[model samples]
Target: MHFQVWLQSIQANGRLKVPESEDVWSLLPSFPLSSFSLSSLSLSSPYLLGIGALASLTVYWLVTRPRPMRPPCDLQAQSVAVEGNPSCRRSALLKDDALLEFYYEDTRTVYDIFKRGLRIAGSGPCLGFRKPGQPYQWIPYTEVAAQAQMLGSGLLAKGCQPNPEQFVGIFAQNRPEWVIAELACYTYSMAVVPLYDTLGLEAMVHIFNLAEISLVFCDREEKASSLMDNKVKGAVPTLSCLVLFGDFSGDLLERGKECGVEVLKLQELMDLGRQNLKDPVPPQPQDLAVVCFTSGTTGKPKGAMITHGNIASNTSSVIKILEGSFVIQQEDVSISYLPLAHMFERMIQVSMFCHGARVGFYQGDISLLMDDIKTLKPTFFPVVPRILNRIYDKILGSVTSPLRRTLLHYAVRRKQAELSSGVVRNNSLWDKLVFNRIQASLGGNLRFILTASAPISPVVLSFLRATLGCLIFEGYGQTECTAGCTFSMPGDWTAGHVGAPLPCTVVKLVDIPEMNYYAKNGEGEICIRGHSVFRGYLRDAERTAEALDSDGWLHSGDVGQWLPNGTLRIIDRKKHIFKLSQGEYIAPEKIENIYMRCFPILQVFVHGDSLQSYLIGIVVPDPEVFADWAKERGFVGSLEELCQNPDVKKAVLEDMRAVGKEAGLKSFEQVRDLYLHPEMFSVANGLLTPTLKSRRVDIRRVFQEQISSMYSKSAP
Candidate 1:
């Protein structure tokens, strides 16, 4: 009988001789396959089983195959639509005036920004700091606001009036009190002048007199004592009061009185403010918020009058860029280890607070920075190249055995390949076996690292990115630009470039004919114009005129080139480029950066004269590396003796040659001869700026005799 007729007859008879377990197969009559006539085939036929298996496999393949991922732009759009607030969505589409309008749509001053953040953050930890050997303790945002209000009121009650032309000075390390003091100033529209803790007493006095500071906030009694010194007091005659974040002994207060100054503790000031809690004046967007002093690499430090709008606008732009590039959550944590006086760190602090991210201050000692980082487990870290170099050196030093070193090298190579190919066949296994430990050293939660202030070695950048499995971004800006004007976007991954101009900012390269730099040649001094630019240098009209032109472009004095992708690569400092007798322009800083990457070399200063054909260098060898080299060569003595040893000099020169070649430097640009210097250049030695940039003028002066001798010997 035919299969369909037999099946219908069995169903009608209700007596089909099928077992209960086989009854499920009878349900196949309800499926579309029922139409297929299989009566001619036996139940054990191979073709019937083959066709059924193929159909099942096809369905499994169709269901289990991977789908293509959405593009980054699409993902960003979706993220904004789903997670972002209405303002954020609107701000993303706004441009130029509209963008600025959007940023200022709800907030005008930093006080406004803080209040908005406080509203969202509620009772969350706002500022965090730790006692020695203790976990971090936090002060809530609401408490911070209340304290700042009381402090501002107290300052006003104590005859400290807000003056647009005058300022209050904050000379301290990063602390909760610093933020409270700054916020208090904002509450009363008082401009703050942040003094670098590393600054010499001379520089401190100079800035105090220059900025006409009326009152100063000191981090400790020691700092407060420094201000009470006769010379410091004499230089800044306008100074009338001192506020100490730490306790002051009776002797210290009496000394302050002798210096014609009144000293008060932080809590005492706050109590006074509570008593004077009346209508307080708020700062306008155009009001000056800070008088940030430049590093003074070449001359006296000029205070850049940064306004509320200048920093607020820059902070807003930075937040917008970072939000698009990274996954920033309110729960994100950060460590504030960089000098808070520096614009870079200060701007980051403002940005973090604005985003409601908790910030922890490191202990006063930098040696404990890693411990602090480990404890904080920060999600975002902003650093300078010096910090990165140290971290890289430590990691390299950890692999003492040759076999482990070789394994690490191979693993790093594999990681680079995996990142490049966008494939991870065994990433989880690799992470478990190798990267987890490294990540754990950094608290195992670091997602992004920002490097700026100076150029970093691309090799270091790549290695860090590969090993940490985190995005490393480079940014370029000076204090004049309110910290950042250009920054590498997440996932861009291109080395030696500082990305494009930030939204609401414009960057252009202008010709420097004297140095042979031209925009037409794709290289020139980078000039910037935007709301982020400083208004002008405080009380230095001549310098301000030199920096900012009538057209509103601030001449950066740093040379850069635009890549095909429109990213900016800093080439050299315009003022530092000197032409040789052969008419070849040489940038010592650029060459120095390359050679400094050598493991044995700690610092380098390349010098070339206008009449010279080749360059000479002053090399500072890494003490530990030099000691090892000295021991191997059977030389035993002080660092000075090791530096002067002929064999050590030869080894250094060889390493320099190898590093220079690897950097692809031109022959003339290479260091032909060098003088080994045992001392490391430092700000205290007057050889480096407060920001750690070498003071070329001072270095040249210090090494003038050696430079002359080297040139005299190489004379043709």
Candidate 2:
């Protein structure tokens, strides 16, 4: 691991991203590298250890940047402080170009990957599901593939065409049947348009007609009946057929006939397909594989047209990137609980399938997810930030006394020290004595956990890494890029930043001058261009044009800053940021994320306008947390009654302010006025989308009077 050998290794094995440390600060978090001693450098740390050439480069980088101490690499919260004018625009590509499709076979389509699995591990346990009181029953890869073929034939037998233009709808929860139905559609060169509960009746009607869905498969009779009702009312005129999984009463068929739609049982459809078997009509790379409708924060959900190439490319990129680090193996098992309708879960599933890994479905109850996890005992765990946050809160909340706190902190520090040195095993006394329960809760076999769909807090990320002793990879992506654009790598202990771009995509940052973000300063709007990028939104050219530039670059609305370690930190969203009257721009989402850590609040919406000088927030408090706070302070009221209490509101606002200050938010960034809403911002309330993201426009319109009142009262 010496310098020249590392230099030879870098030239041979890695494409070293030489940091322009001329303007950026040091690599270490504690102090400036200018004051750092070279003797302290580890020769085998994989940061091209301190040898002659690397040492000279490090010396040049540290000495050239005589800047003040930049903010810590692990951003505490809304801290994105810069100290110097950077000298160059920045972009990051793969550490090695040969990795883009290295582990991946020449799979041009999604079905090709499935076939590869069929060749490699045909007899292996593939999809597994569980009954209420029974163990998981697995369907072998060969059997599952045969079932998909039969179902695809069944789709054709029931007047469903194999044209890519004609989409078959899948409206069901995540299950074996949901996947089989999707794969069936792929088998016939057809596409699937997923229908979810969050879409609402109006949105469902829109999707049914927008995709001109003639036949749909659902798991429940209730969903089938509701969809039939829409068809009967002529709201969804093109919807003529309904397929329900499992058993159903004959009366449903009578109702379907009355509604002019045919209802077929899952077994009945399979029998029909078996009787009328046909050859597979595989799709080309450019053919539409799915029309994934995104649950957006505003307006009707837009359908993102994902091609076979889009999915295959993204899957290949992910597999290749994870090859040497945290590779998915044939023995690996993962529990499928996240929304399968979303590209994020679908991408993960495909990766698992490609490696012949086992995927088990949850029992469909959030409360029993842990029970299901223990039952399945998955080797690989995939999650979101919210899931990790709950684990962090629950673990910390259990420490009731000073002694326990001290012991916990000491254990965490010890584990964290070992973790920084690349040790991630449950071999320590602390792991056996204290963290075993935490690990056991997740079935105790997790080697790695991959989190995406949101940025995880550095504290929570670090805490989970220390306690669980698992390599937790933080990924940043959206549906637009087929779920993953940048994923953190192994051995990178630094937090608050997503890792470098995948070899499938080239990530670049362009200056967003209006927001004071410059690429030369290592800050700007992130733009991605590569095979993994999705095709434009289905039939929505205007938005597609807005997202994809004249060049191939897909302009991510997210603002990113390149870290000294050549990683990207998502700092803000350009579309969501608003400016105050005094000209300081406010990123409401960034502030909201920080404020969400406040105990009393369950959900928060920070609003700022150019006409206003200060910010206002509408928070939906956690009833339990509020009750605890009220009881401790001799206050008396239900959540509704407390919302009207000036004292309660004042206390909540003060708590928010304190949390914001701790997160290092500036005065303007802090909410000056607060409204405690008794009601939750749920999907039913029109404030949240099905995905639980706040619908800002609807929330604003619904609480316009309250917003106006808050601003008026706070006015000078």
Candidate 3:
């Protein structure tokens, strides 16, 4: 009776399904239970016992099977308690299916990435550098890796052990040696501390001292000399050696010796490395790879600690997005002109290298950037808005003829319409006649151009897209996120939005109640949490804690709003926004961007205070434009003298009003009074950051008296 009940339970559960044509005894394979023989029992009882025992064994196996192990780096599975809210748990942004696949599959370090690229690109040109009035010199991938290995061996031989805490500094402009030195450091797990070549002496001294950089690689003799100078060397006593990319002069060597530091040439180091080449210590993904300093627009520069995994993960996501949206091919080429010390350029370099793309460095002069662009004919160009503004001004200035200007205007409108309609049936004849020439100026093979660092004017963006006949993508990020957090994809041509967040990067808006920025209103401070976010500010725990919350979100000070299309639109910087006496909030950057589009204005600083009812501006007129205006009006004076002239002041004020109106700025937002300055804000003047962004605090301090006088005079 028990055996019969077991058989009935198995049948009810659908665990056993016998074929209609086959008998139950036949399906049992003539097998018997451990203690019962099939022949000894009746056929029906034998079948029931055999099926019941088989079902029991199957259930036992199912219940006792071992489970598969989970990956150690599964960020989503590791939840942490949020500070002040113990009930809330926060995890890394790994919910996206594509991001999860990438996270699990791509488990390589910076060194590993380089090796993979080398294997694929063997003899292909990896790094190219050109001197003024000379052809470009190309170094293949294999050669770069071999030299990097040798350099790593040489550094180890010279008592430079693999110490992740003690960093090596790369203080130079964009060059081939800069990248090679960076890679060599990775071979021995040394963190690279990149110092912007344009940093002030004091700033440079601060970084060298802060990071405790023992060895520094200098691009030229002058750089080595400047660092080894008596005054600066005293400030950075921790620096022990200098490696010059160029031939080390005896004078520079003597200067280093006087400073109690050793000096060696790059060639000598490479030779030493070749002699000492042996087993190398490879860097791990979690090891500190770089300590990139912020531009210090607000205060003293803070070094952001970026790990090998941070770079690898960010670069991989970037490559995936670019390839998906822009179809980046292995044969694509790029020109490296931006300061590589900035994470933006550095990230691009790594991504290009990862995909086996060739990179050509520009001659160190900005004036020759266009000439180099023409020669290199890069397929991919990453630029700042300043460069784009200059290009637009130069191109528009050249259209002196009315007929040509009219034709160009029509072409731009027609192209814009086609882009909006998304029905590009055929290329317009105007493209072949007018736009093709503009494209040729940018190497003709250009597919897309990337703009970042600041918000670009929509007019300029549209004009460039129409004229060049190439897609324009704007990406938003900071040093904290390894450069890219969000990017505008190909079909995402919204005028003001920065498109969507990159895969694996989760971007959300958080409330800034004091500033009236709220996520509920679709505007707030942009916060990010993901693989790309840096570990923290090196050696600055308080600042790091403030920036990165216990929930692991990096609270970016930038303010943004969500667009209707689910994209991000940067509104204004929370710190840069100031409330006027009338309780009107003004975004100086927005106003500055508007006035900058005016032909006469070269650079402008919009200033306001909570105590003041109106706005005042410091405008720097374009030298050439100002000269032309002065000549046409028969005004006789230097630029400085002309700035004080009422006529010139009135002309600039009128232009500002026109631009502000065109930009749809509110009445309270317009600059009511202004002062013309002949000199432009620059890094040398301590009024601009190395990245060419205005240092607002410094500017306000420097022009304090001028601003006060202007406000006093304008009082009713």
Point out the higher-scoring one by TM-score: 2 or 3: 2
RMSD to native for every prediction? 9.1, 11.8, 17.1
Worst 10 residues of 3 by lDDT: 67-76
Per-residue lDDT tens digits for candidate 3, residues 73-162, read: 221222222343222222322342234213324346777777777766889999998877777889999889888989988888778878
Best-first order by TM-score: 1, 2, 3
- The digit string of per-residue lDDT tens for model 1 on 573-646 reads 87677888898888888888889799878899998887878888899987756776667767778899988887
Per-prediction backbone clash count:
1, 0, 0
- How many clashes show up in model 2? 0
Candidate with the greatest lDDT versus the true structure = 2
Candidate rank order under lDDT = 2, 3, 1
The C-alpha stretches of model 3 lying farther than 4 A from their native spots are: 1-107, 230-233, 421-428, 624-642, 701-705
lDDT of each: 0.76, 0.79, 0.77
**How big is the positional error of residue 302 in model 2, measured in Å on the Cα after superposition?**
1.2
